[model samples]
Target: MQAFSEILDQWKTQQPEDNRDDYYKIFTAVKDFDKHIARRYDGLRNSWFLGTVTALLAEKIITTSDLEDFSEEAKSKIARALKFREQYEL
Candidate 1:
């Protein structure tokens, strides 16, 4: 499977602002669905769902900085993402 970062990278290049906005919306919806599924199912692990969310967030902020021009919004997102990177540790 293609990595989440690669998928987000492609979407970033498209620069579909409206779609990008909706992407977050749809992601949240799907995540909620997955959370429900996990709760309803016996074998589902919370980490599985959370890992996907974390991966998507990391992809948006780690794979590109095209939003850097926006304002502190972009900066904060980038900063939050970078925390996952080892370089930020020390």
Candidate 2:
């Protein structure tokens, strides 16, 4: 499995935005998500990895249709994250 940071770096390279403001939004969201996970789970974390996914979706950076093409492992991770979010209302 790729670390969340590695995945972000890969996306940054692949997407190549000339303007960085949107990318900063993603970075901030992920950072906030990590902090929340640390506080709520006492460092027993899972959903932090989904921060970028959530942010991207919310910002319309990616679509639900795009998610349909994700690898099985990616899909599983997203499912787990969404489950966690729903359960905790976070």
Candidate 3:
């Protein structure tokens, strides 16, 4: 993703002199990111679509307007999921 790439790219300019520290930082960042990517993006099934969209909305990676193309029922489901997340998960 563009955001992920930008975050990785930033390491090039951060503490370049400390090779050991930089290696550890980059290693940890990439390992954490890899885990997230595996959990979120890998093996994406249709059943996960609505929940994933709701999460993306909560994370502000996507806008509410993006749901305009989906059916009203789907949009409603996502709205409810978001409401539940906001009220309970926070």
lDDT string, candidate 3, 1-90, tens digits: 665566557766674665886567667778887999799989999999899999999989999999889999999999999999999984
The predicted structure with the larger lDDT, 2 or 3, is 3
Candidate 2 scores a C-alpha RMSD against the true structure in Å of: 12.6
lDDT of 2 by residue, 1-90 (tens): 134566577667777655476567667778977886566457434556466675456555677687886788887777676667768866
lDDT of 1 at 58: 59
Candidate 1 clashing pairs, residues 3+ apart or interchain: none
lDDT of 2 at 90: 69
Candidate 1 local lDDT, 1-90, one digit each (tens): 234455577677876757866577557667876786566465647645434433445556334444445467555654565576536542
Model 2 residue 11 lDDT score: 69
Question: Model 3 — which ten-residue stretch has the worst lDDT?
Answer: 1-10
TM-scores, all models, native as reference: 0.28, 0.36, 0.76
**Candidate 3 segments exceeding 4 Å error:** 1-17
11 Cα displacement, candidate 1 (Å): 16
